[model samples]
Target: MFGAVPALLTYYWCMKMPETARYMALVARNAKQAASDVSKVMQVEIEAEEEKVDKIGTASSNSFGLFTREFAQRHGLHLLGTSVCWFLLDIAYINNLFQKDIFSAIGWLPKAETMNAIHEVYRVAMSQTIIALCGTIPRYWFTVVFIDYIDKFTIQLMGFFFMTVFMFALAIPYDHWLSNSAGFLIMYSLTFFFANFGPNATTFVVPAEIFPEKLRLNCHSISAASGKLVAIVGALGFPYAAQNKDPSKTDADYPPGNGVRNSLFLLGGINCLGIFFTFLVPECKGKSLEEITGEKEEADANDMQQASSTQTFPV
Candidate 1:
């Protein structure tokens, strides 16, 4: 598990690595420094783009360091709220997948010799494959659109609320021949659907918005690590909880579907808690990435003005 986690963390670190000279010039407030960082990382010399520097270097204002400012107090609260929401979302989302038996949950599968058990396992494995095919891959599109057009906080909250409704549907028993089948599809669809549009996307976006430049990368990494911590704890414990039937009990006591159902209920409660927490984040969409970083535009303007003045005069 530790090995797998570092592999995952490596992917995120790469994604968040310093990339653009544009971000660097604005964040570092020094064309020379920005060009140096870019050249080092990109493995090529970059001429200082003098016209592009914002002068104040406030573009990089996003950092975990901002929490100390009076102005940052409100955003700090939002970050804290979003962090909790992210933690719960990770727990529930992963627990649902674990319940599906993709992780080889301990003692859950029937003995290899039982044809019925083998058939059931194969059916579920195939069904889950089809579900991932239809539901998981296309989510990128919805995330791009919603993160751009919708209120991010509201979308995340709605995703959790709707998940609760799907859980309620699963908890109820219906008489129709296809009722359980329909319910499962609806529930799974909702799960993946929101994954694209809600907390899954928002959690990543929020840290980028709220922090100042110097601390942004480190804090975002920490936030991601925290979420993963929640997921790891659940992953380790859920299988044992789901499959361990009392040795003395009759065969009927531990039904095949019972563990999955219980796991869903556990996730449903976490989703509810997540919705309540979403209210804390500020609406940061439409703000320039620099402004979100907490850079002062006026300071940037003044610095540029002085630089221009310096250029006009004799040395």
Candidate 2:
């Protein structure tokens, strides 16, 4: 019921929001509406570029359908990069949901049977809050401050590299951490820190900037959907994968498996893979949207070249 209030408030505000200026101008071919929207927001007297919009709309180079060879030729590698990175990030990120199992295994958290329902909820919530305070929230501010100065690619690369390091650091000496819960909590917190600071932030932003205006929404949606799909798989699979291999240590009604140490190693390996995929996304810092996508330049040049070829001079 509390969640419903926020959802209702958001819905009211979302309904008043206009379609993006880029979408209006490019895909909708409504340069006037686009100009109007921008003028309202920027509080400036802006004229609609109907001729420019018409030229772009008529250009064959810009008019290709989403599934055509042209799109593949242009953005295939970019799409792959965005999709794979998001998929890998979610795979690692979903482990947060299994924190209770992980904490119990490491002796940081008490077993569920030791506490009543209310107490259990309080303990779990407190652990999650600690992690958020130490790891997740601070890293987000760090990303916000440095992203413009340092570039998304470098931040994401650094994030994945550190996450891999921390995961391995926790996994390799798993027994040691079992005795030292403070050290374990610190290392565990670092993973969430780098995650928000790295590919998690870049993957969402890069997809929007890299694709052409006409296809931008589709590409971003595809990338986001890929992440969501991996999150679902990871949520369902991680608990089983992290189950104690020894029958004596295993939870009731659950089969023994590779255990938490191996699970951390697996997640670390996934973060390592994210580093390579991050190379696929291009840096868009300080560049115009048209410059990054090459849509405006390519379409304008094609249209001009075509006009030049078809022109007839008076004899």
Candidate 3:
């Protein structure tokens, strides 16, 4: 019920929003509506260029389907970069799934068995709130402020690198942190900080900006879906994988396994993989959508006039 409120609000706002001018003009071939939408948003008069839209649409190169050889040659590396980076990003879902165990191990939160249900809920909520306040929320704003200045590729690479560093710092010396709860909390919080400030934010932005307007939504959906699929797998698998090898410490009915220390090591390795794949995604900062996706070349090849190009709002 609580989740439904935000969903309903999002749906309402999305419904009210106009389609992007590029999508309206190119894919839907509705230059008039595209011009009108852009005019309203920019608060300037703009004429529809139906003839220009038709010319661009009829270009054989721009008409390629997503799965065609042309698209493969053009954007296959991009799709692979977006999809794999998202996949690697969500592999860190293990951090969320096992956060409580990590906290208890460091003596931050009391063990679940020590508290009644209400008390357990209170402690868990408080701990999560602290992590969010100290780590998550601040980093989101950091991305918003620095994304343009630093660029997406640099931020993501830096983020994944630091997250990898912190994960190993926590795991490699797991016993040392157990004795220093404050130090452990700081390190744990840093992981969350870099995760948000780095690939978590860029992954979403890059897919939207890098794909052609016609294929943007589909490509973004595929990238996001890959992330979500990995998240589900991490949620289900990490618990068992992180179980203590000592039978006495293992959860009821769960077999002993590599435990949280090794699990953090694995997650660190995944973040390292994210760094490698980040190279595959092109830097889209300071480039227009058309330039990034090669739509400008198609328009120029057709000898499109400046006035017609402006009317299409080739963002």
Candidate 4:
């Protein structure tokens, strides 16, 4: 309820903000409108490009639709990189988010039927809150501080690698950890910590940085949608797999281990696979958007005039 209230307020605030100047200029091709909106906010006079003129740095022929061969030849791998990483990361992420197996594993979580319904909900929320405060929140801050210095690629790779290692450690000795509640909790928290500190944050940040301004928003939208789609898969898949009986177990009470251990092994393998896809992603730190994407219209605009380069007169 506390979280929902702020989101509602923020939605209201966002609704009141004006359309961005970038969309008006690039997507709508309404330079006048974009300039007007920008100038009003900036309190400055500015010239608007005529609708038919080519953008200053880019030739008209340089542009291509996203689905065109030119785009595929140039950026298809980049798109694939973002989509694959987002998908793999979210599968692991959403499983952890939706499963809450850590609580059950630690043996501290009371079954829902054993507790008052409200108390059960409170216990779940409070347990998750502790994980968030001690593990999730700190990791996010760590990402924010080091994303530029250490770079998103390195962070995400390290995060995925560590997460894989930890999950395997937890899953392979599942029975052992179940008996050791304190160690189980520590191990569980490290996964969350690495997740936030790694690809979970980088995936969101890099998509917004590495595309041309004209197409950046669309690319990011596609990447994020891929993540959500994978989340749906995780939601449906993890629970089903967790409940499956292991074929190797004969005891009815201990039917073959529902495939939880196998799923962890799978998740770890997916993380390992994600590393290959991640290599397709460019290292975007310290580079301007144009430099990253190789579309220099905005950056080159200041240097070009009509048909000739403007020569600066030395003062």
Candidate 5:
């Protein structure tokens, strides 16, 4: 109830916003509308760069469209890069999320049978809040602070490497940490931290930057869809693999986990593979969106120069 209200209300504000300059200029190819939107949003006049785009008549020349040979040679790699990284990152992240019992096993949370349904819900909420405060929230700020300074590629690489280390650290001595709640909590939380500060954020940011605006939304949707698909598969498959065979055994030790351990090890290996995939996504930090996409660079620059020349800057 607390979080849901604000989230629902936010759509009203978002709906109020005009179409972005990127979509107007790049996708719609309506530079006058794009410039007018910029002027409206910024409360200033902006010169329309339609003349340059008109001169090039790129729409006529590049009739091959998104699936063309030219597009494949130019941007197919970036499409693959964004898709694979998002897929790998979400598979691990969502699987970790679905396996929420790890937190209940830790020291702070009370056993379920001891608490009533309401109390259990309250406790779960409180625990998640604490985890967000300690691990999830801080790491987001960490990424925002350093994503520009250190660059997106390095952050993503370091995140996967550390996630592998932490997952292995937790999985290798699973029984030991099972009894040692503080140790398990620390290791588990570190994975959560790195996932946020690393690939999770980068996956979203890079796609928007690397792909040309015309195909940007398509690439991001495809990449995001792939991530969700794998996440569902992993979530469904891992539990089945971890299911208990013995009638007398509890769910906790069911994996006794030569089988259960497989999931953790699999996720760790997935992160290990992610390090290699991260290389496919080029570093875009400190570069303009124009430089990264390199589609119609001359025309894109003319649009910016035209808009910038007319718009007054703060001294």
Candidate 6:
């Protein structure tokens, strides 16, 4: 009975849809009737009511329309790259997130179990909160007041560097407290902090800035969807890894060491990979979005000119 609900809802919506005026005019070639029908359905008076009216002639001609033949391929690739990176980053980000519960499994529990979950959740939530806070406030403080102008690349690279190192560190065995399980957690926390400051925020901004105005929405959607895909992959795989991980064995037995450590390593590598990928992207600091993309065209033109200039003259 519950399964039939979806079909019933779909049928209800299907009945509400108006007939297509484009189909009627193009297929039936009855412009006068199509305009009249469209006018009533849309409640907008189309200026001219003619039997041979083209729909494209109407007031609804969208310039620079997304996914149009001219815009699709270059636009699609531009968006696809952003989308893939976002997917991988978000997957790595969120997968490690929910899997934090495995910390408890590793006997990294807090004093009171209830307080522990609350604090754990708070720490997880607040870590991002703090990073966002720092990003918003400290950026100005660091750049303006301190004269410490860290570029986008530097911040991203630092996040990647630390992520890789910590991940590798987590791969080492730490059976005893003095061996420093808590220290690993601290490093993970710090990496997460830097990620928000760097690639996590900038990657999205970079792609959106680089693509043409026509392709912005498509690029943004693809990038966002890619991030979600990464999240799903990480979420699904991390748990299986954690359950299979034998903490009793040395950390190396698992993929990156112990499950937690492995997770850190995965995140660290992914973060750094995201940084490396940023190099392929055109850097757009201090420039208008138009200028950023325009530079690429200008660069290509220059290369063509240089090639032409280098051609050997007939002897």
Q: In angstroms, how far off is 13's CA in candidate 2? A: 1.6
Worst 10 residues of 2 by lDDT: 53-62
Report the Cα lDDT for candidate 1. 0.64
For each candidate, give its TM-score against the true structure.
0.68, 0.93, 0.92, 0.79, 0.81, 0.55
Which stretches of model 6 miss by more than 4 angstroms? 1-80, 95-99, 110-149, 173-179, 244-258, 295-315
Worst 10 residues of 1 by lDDT: 102-111
lDDT (tens digit, per residue) of candidate 1 on 1-315: 788998999999999886666555655556887788878988998888666564444333333254467435635666677678778878877755454442223233444345486686885676666656656666677787656788787778777887777665554432221234544665566676776567887888887766655666766776787799988897766654455244432133443334545666777788888888887766777787556645656557767888988886557
lDDT of 6 by residue, 88-136 (tens): 5675566444434445544554423457666867755654454446343
lDDT for predicted candidate 6 compared with the true structure: 0.56
Clashing residue pairs for model 5: none
Model 2 misplaced regions, further than 4 Å: 299-315
Which of the predicted structures, 4 or 6, would earn the higher lDDT when compared with the native?
4
Q: For candidate 2, give the lDDT of residue 260.
A: 91
Off by over 4 Å in 1: 1-18, 26-29, 33-55, 58-74, 101-113, 116-121, 174-179, 244-259, 297-315
Q: Write the per-residue lDDT of candidate 4 for residues 256-309, one digit (tens) a residue.
A: 445556777777888787777889998977776656776565346544664265
How does candidate 4 score on lDDT? Answer: 0.75
lDDT of 5 at 9: 83
Candidate 5 lDDT tens digits, 1-315: 799889878988898878888777766778999899889889999999886645444643223367888778877887888889899898788655534455544446676667898997887787667667767989978987888798989989999999999988887887787679777767777898999999998898888888776677788899999898998887766665554344343254445333435567878998998898888888988887767766457666767988989998789
TM-score of predicted structure 1 = 0.68
Q: In order, what lDDT does every prediction score?
A: 0.64, 0.88, 0.88, 0.75, 0.76, 0.56
Model 2, span 1-315: residue lDDT tens: 797999999999999999999889878999999999999999998999999887766655468878998888888889999999999999999888779888898787787788898998998899999999999999889988998898888988998999999999999999999999988999999999999988889888889888888888899999999999988888888888888899877777888878899999999999999999989888888888877887668876887898999999999
Pairs with steric clashes in candidate 3: none
* Tens-place lDDT digits, model 3, residues 3-60: 8999999999999988889889989999999999999999999999899888876666
